[model samples]
Target: MRMNYEENAKIFKAVSDQSRLKIIDILSCGERCACDILEYFDFTQPTLSHHMRVLSNCGLIEVRKEGLWNYYRLNINNCNKLTLFMMNLVTETKDCICNDKSKCTCK
Candidate 1:
């Protein structure tokens, strides 16, 4: 409950976009340049840049520049943190919350 709700919301929002999620999927294969990613879609450069910017702001992806091209890769630490956060959410909370309002001490 004390977590940074705004930051977590930003991550969720960024990944909510189909384009951004596809970008993550592309990066999962390996690090790729903007040109490579752009090739997979029919959107214009500026539009793709916009999507990339959103993903970067979410702390999910990192980009590096090489000459004129930009390479994108997943931020393993942040990704791991998000994954662990979700896992903990599922594991910590008991399933029968509504039925038993007596002794729920699993936090």
Candidate 2:
């Protein structure tokens, strides 16, 4: 599904969670099975599955089943959409000038 701006914002917020961010970082490298993801975390199978479900729900990741294995793939298209939006913001807002301050709220 094509997520609108609000929906995509919710997705970014979801991925802001620590564990979820780690999951995305791992997937950023390449696709991995559910079992493989579980091996690196202290969470139980159900917990990891829940995190995967959230990621899938946000369209940040795509999933597939292969016999007894389930694989997770990064939704790079969605990622590109987000990246482009950020790039556009930086490009469009030519005079934001908040970056050079000692401390900025945008951070």
The per-prediction tally of clashing pairs is: 0, 0
Q: After superposing candidate 2 on the true structure, give the runs of residues whose Cα lies further than 4 Å from its correct spot.
A: 1-4, 93-107
- Model 1, residue 21: distance off in Å is 0.6
Whole-structure CA lDDT of model 2? 0.83
RMSD to truth, every model = 4.8, 7.0
lDDT of 2 by residue, 1-107 (tens): 22256876888887888999999999999999999998889999999999999989988899999998899999999888887766655563534444446666564
Superposed Cα deviation of residue 92, candidate 1 (Å): 2.3
- Quote model 2's TM-score: 0.77
Candidate 1, lDDT over the whole model: 0.84
- What overall lDDT goes with each candidate model? 0.84, 0.83
By summed lDDT, the worst window of 10 consecutive residues in model 1 runs over 90-99
Global fold similarity of model 1 (TM-score): 0.80
